[model samples]
Target chain A: MLEIKGLKAKVEGKEILHGIDLAVPAGEVHAIMGPNGSGKSTLGYVLAGREGYEVTDGQALFKGRDILALEPEERAAAGLFLAFQYPVELPGVTNATFLKSALNAVRKARGEGELDAMQFLKRVRGIMKSLGMAEDMLKRGVNVGFSGGEKKRNEILQMAVLEPRLAVLDETDSGLDIDAMRIVADGVNALRGPGRAMLVITHYQRLLDYIVPDRVHVLMGGRIVRSGGPELARELEQKGYGSLPAAA
Target chain B: MARTAQTSRVTAPAPALAAQLARYAGLKDRLAGAGLPWLRDLREAAAQALAANGLPTPRTEAWRFTNLRPLHDLSFAEPVALVGSEAERAALALLPALGRWRAVLVDGRFRADLSELDGLPEGLAVQPLASALHAGAAGLDGLLGTLARPDQEPMAALNTALMEDGVIVRVAPGVKVAERLEVVSIASAPAERAIAFHPRLLVTLGADASLILVDTALGAGAAAYLNNPVAEVDLAPGASLDHVRVQDEGPAALHLATVYARVAERARYESFTLSLGARLARNEVHVTLAGADGDCSVHGAYLAHGQRHIDNTSIIRHAAPACRSRQVYKGVLKDQSHGVFQGKIEVDQIAQKTDGYQMNQAILLSPEAEVNSKPQLEIYADDVKCSHGATVGELDEAQLFYLRSRGVPAEEARAILVQAFFGDALEQVPDEGLREALSALIAGWWEREGGAG
Candidate 1:
C-alpha cells in the first residue's frame, strides 16, 4: 500500500533521512524502530507531506500516487494520516467541531454524503466509549487543556473516525503510560484489517508488545540497517541499538 | 484660521477639515433645536471649537497610531433625509430586527412609523431626540454636554454643532425593564454624494433602574460617508446598564463614534462592541466609575481586512473607593488592514482598594497586516490593584498545520483558529441574542473577506 524508494529528506539544510528504501504491503502493519536522532520521525513527516521536511531526492508513493506533489490537506484527503507527536491546541474550536469538520471534509472529498449532527454524535460517542474517554471533552476546546493521555486518545479517536487507508503513527507512545498504551493499542489494533496499512514509528519496544507488527525495521544513522520480523524488536531490545551496524 | 494651541499639536491640518467646516458653517441655524436659547448656545460654542480645534492629527498622542488623513482627504455634506422614500424602505428592510422595542434611524433621522413605541411603560420613555427637545424633556439641557464637551474633543464638538436627530432613552427610578431595547442606525447615502451625520444618543437610568440596550450601526452605499455618533450614558445609584454596540459599517464609509458613560454608587455598566465594517472606523469609549462598589466592564472584538483600518480606544476611571473595572479587546487583521487598540485605566488616590484589569490581543492573518496596541495603567491609589497587557501575533503555525492535517482545508482551518481568538470576548456578552448576532458578524468577516492580498 505504501512504497518509498531512496527516501532521502532533510530539515533546515541538514539531511535527516538518507537513501532509505521501505515498503508496506496492503493489510500488513510495519514498525520502524530507532534510537534518538535516527530519522524515524523524519520518514513519517516526509511521507505525510509536512512543510519544511524537504524531500531532496526520493519518491514516496501511497496507493500508486506520488504524494510529494500534494499539499498536506490533499494528502490527508487522499487517505494519508499522520498522528503527530504533539497535538496542537485550538483554543476556540470545540473537539466535536474539529472532529466533525475533519470527518466531513474527508468524506466529501471521497464523494460521500456528510453526516449530520445526530449521526456524528452517535458514532463519536460510541468510539469514545470504547476508548474510555469522557464525553465532556467534546464540548471543550480541542486539546487546549487536555493531559497527554487525553490528547493521544483524541488522536486515536481521530484515526478511528477518519479510517484512512494508510496511517503513520509517529512516536505515539512517547508520553503514554502502560495502561494508556494498552487502550491506544487496542484502538489501533482494532483498526487493523485487510484494506488498511500502518507504519508505527517508535523508540521503545514496549508499545510493540501490545500491537505486534507484521514487520520490524531498525532505522539507524538515517538508514534502515536491518530488517526482520517481530523477533527483531526483542533482539534489538536485548542488545541496544549501539550494537547494530554503524555503516550508513 | 483660528487654531488652538492644543490644535497646533495636531500636525498639518488636512484641507478637508477646512472645506467641511466651510460647507457646514450655516448648519447651526438648521439643526433640530435651533430656536432654543440653551441648545442654540451649546451649538454655537461647539461650532467655534470645531473650527478652532479642527480634527486630531497623527502628531496628537492619542491619535498617533491612526492617521485621519483619509477622513481629512474627503469632504462630507449633511445627509439628505430619506425618511419616507423607497430607498428608506429598502434600507429599513436590510436591518435585522432584534427586539420588540426597536428604533430605526435612517440617515440620522428617526422614523416613528418604523419604530414600535406604542406600549412603552409609563416610566420608560423612548422617543426621537427632535421630538424630545421640542417637547422639552425634563433635565435634557443639563445632561446633554455634561460628560462630552466641545473644547475637550473636536470630534464631539463637530457632532454637537451639526447634531440633527437621534434617540432619547430614559428610565425612571425603581423600574426594571425585562425586555431588551434596540437601536439600528443605517447610513444610506446616494451613490454619488458623500454624506456625514452626527447623532446624539443620550441615555439615563434613574436610581435602582435596569436596562439592556443593543445599538447596531451599519452603512449601505457605494460612496463613502461618515457616521459620527456621540453617546452619553448616566447610571444612577444601584442601576445597571448592559450595552452592546455592533459597528458593521459598509466598505465605502467611515464610522467614528464617541461614548461617555458614568456609573454611580453600587451601579454596574457593562458594554461590548463587535466592529466588523467600514473603510476606516474608530469607536472610542470613556467610562468613569463615580461611586464605591461600582463595576464596569468594557470588552470588544474587531475584524478587519482589505485596506480597512479599525480602532478601539477606551479610558476607564475609578473615581471612588472599592470600584472594579475590566477591559478585554481582541482584533484579527488580514491583508494590509491595520488595527489599533489604546486602552487606559486610571485609579484616583481617593479610590482606594480599586481593582482594574485590561488586556488587548491581536492576530495578524497576513504578513502585511499590522496592529498597534497600547494598554496603559495609571494608579494613584496606594491600595489599588491594576494590571494591563498587550500581545500581537499571527495564528499558531503548529495549530494551523494540525487542523489542516486533519483534512480541514487551510482556509477553513484558519477561520476556526481565528474564531477561537474571539471566544472569550464574545462570552463577555450576557445576552444570547446579542452574542449570536456578534458571532454571525465575526463569521461573516471570515467568510467574505478575501485572504490578505
Candidate 2:
C-alpha cells in the first residue's frame, strides 16, 4: 500500500535520509529499528509532507499515486497518517474541537456528509473508552498539560478516529512506561485489519513484543542495511546492532 | 499657561493645540450645560490644561511609539446635528444584540427615538448626560469629570472641554441590575469634512451593587471624523462592575477613548476592550483600587490590518492594602498596520500585600507589520508582588504544521491558532453571552482580513 524508491531527503542543507527503498504491502505490519539520528523520524516527516525537509530525489507512492507532491492536509485526506513522537500542545483549543475539525475536513474532502456534534461525541466516547482515556480529556485543551503516556495514547486515539489506510508510528513507545506501552499496543492491535498497513518505527525491540510485526528491518547510517523476519528483532536484542555483519 | 508649561518642564503645546483652542473657542458657548456656572468653570479649566499640554507627540515619553502626526495635520470641524438615517439604522442592526437595555447615540447626541429605556428596574437610573445636567441631578455634580485627570490625559481633557452628550447610568445601594446595559455610539458625519465630537459617560454603582456595561463604538459612512469619548466609573464598597467596550469605527475615522474607574473596598472591576477598525485608535484605561481587598482586571484584544493603527494603554494603581489587579492585552497586525501596548502597574507604599500582574503579547502576520510592547511595574511597598511581561512573535510553524497535518487547511489552521491566541484575553470576559458575542466579532474580522492571504 505504501512504496518509497530511492527516497533521498535533507533538512537545512544536511542530508538526513540517503538513497533508500522500502515497501509495506496491504495488511502487513513492518518495523524499522534504528539508533539515534538514523533518519527514522525524518522518513515519517517526509512522508507526511512536512515543510523544511527537501526531497532532492526519489518519489513516495501511496496507492500508485505520487504522495510527495501533495500538501499535508491533502495527504491526510488520502488516508495517510503520521503519529508524531511528540504531540503538539494547542492551548485554548479543546481536544473535541480539534478532532471534530480534522474529522470533518477529511470527511468533506472525501465527499462524505459531516457529522453533527452529538454524532461526533458518540463516536469519540467509544474510542475514548477503549483507549482508557477519561471523558474530561476531551474537554481540556489539546495535550496542554497531558502526561507523556497520555500524549502517546492521544496520538493513537487520533489514529483510530481517522482510520487511515496506512499509518506511520514514529517512536510512539519511546517515553511510555510498560503499562502505557501495553495500552498503546492494544490500541494499535485493535486497528489491525486486512485493509490497513502500519510501519512501527522504534529504537528498542521491547515495543515489538506486544504488537508483533510481520517483518523487521534494521536502519543504520540513514539506509536499511538488513531485512529479515520477526526473529531479526530478537536476534538484534540479543546481539546489539554493533555485532551485526557489515552490509554487502 | 505658558509659565506653567515652562516651570513644569513640559513640552510646549504644538500648533495643533492652538488650532483646537481656536475651534473650541467657537463652540464653547454651544457646549452642553453651558449655562451651569460650575460646568462652565470645569470646561474652562480643562481647556487650559489641554492648551498647556498640547497633543501628545512621538517625542513625549508616554507617546513614544504612537505618532499623532496624522491627527495633527487634519483640521476637525465641529460636529453637526445628525438624525439616524436608513443606512445608519442598517449599520446599527448589524451590531450584536447581546444586551437588553440599549441606548443609542448618533453623532455624539443621544437618539431618544432609537433608545429603549422602558421597563428599567427600580433603584436604577439611566438617562442622557444632557438631560441629567439639565435636571441638575443630585449626585451628578461631583461625578462628572472627577475620576479622569486632565493633566495626564490630554485627549480626555479635550473631551471634557467640548463634551457634547453621552449616557449616565446609576444603580442605587444594594441593587443588582441583572440585564446588561449597552451604550452604542455611531458616528455619521455630514459630508467628507473631518468632524469631531466628545461624548462623556458617567457610571456609578452604589455599595453592594452589581452591573454590566457594554460600550460599542461604530460608524456608518466612510467620511473622515473623530470619535473621542471619556467614561468615568465609580464603584462603591463591595460593588462589582463588568465593562466591555468594542471599537469598530469606520475605516476613515479616528477613535480615541479614555475610561477612568475607581474601585472601592472589596469591590471588583473587570473591563475588556476589543479594537477592530479605524484609521488610528487609542483606548486608554486608568483604574485605581482605592479600598482594601479590591480586585481589578483589564484585558483587551486588538486586530489591525491595512494601514490601521491601534494602541492600548492602561495604568493600574493599588492604593489600598491587599488589592489585586491583572492586565492582559493581545494584538494581531497584518499588512503595514501598527500596534502598541503600554501597561503600567503602580503599588503605593501604604498598599501592603498588594498583588499585580501584567502581560502583553502580539503576533505580526506581515514583515512590514509592527508592534511595540512596554510593560512597567512600579512597587514602593516591600510586601507587594508585581510581575509584568511582553512578547512579540510570529505564528508557531510547528503548531501550524500539526494542525494542517490533521487535515485542517492552512487558512483554517491559521484562523484557529489566531483565535486561540486571542482566547486567552477573551476568557476574561465575566459574562458568557458577551464573550460569545465578542468572539463572533473577532471571527468576522479574521474572515475578512485573514482569509486566503
lDDT per residue, candidate 2, B70-168, as tens digits? 788888887666645886688888887868889989888899988888888997888999887767655667788889788778998899898878999
Name the TM-score of candidate 2. Answer: 0.96
Task: Please list the Cα RMSD from the true structure of every candidate, rounded to 1 decimal place.
Answer: 2.6, 2.8
Q: Judged by DockQ cut-offs, is candidate 1 incorrect, acceptable, medium or high?
A: medium
DockQ values per model: 0.79, 0.79
Model 2 spans with C-alpha error above 4 angstroms: A245-248, B1-15, B189-191
In terms of lDDT, the best-performing candidate is: 2
Over 4 Å off, model 1: B1-15, B19-25, B450-453
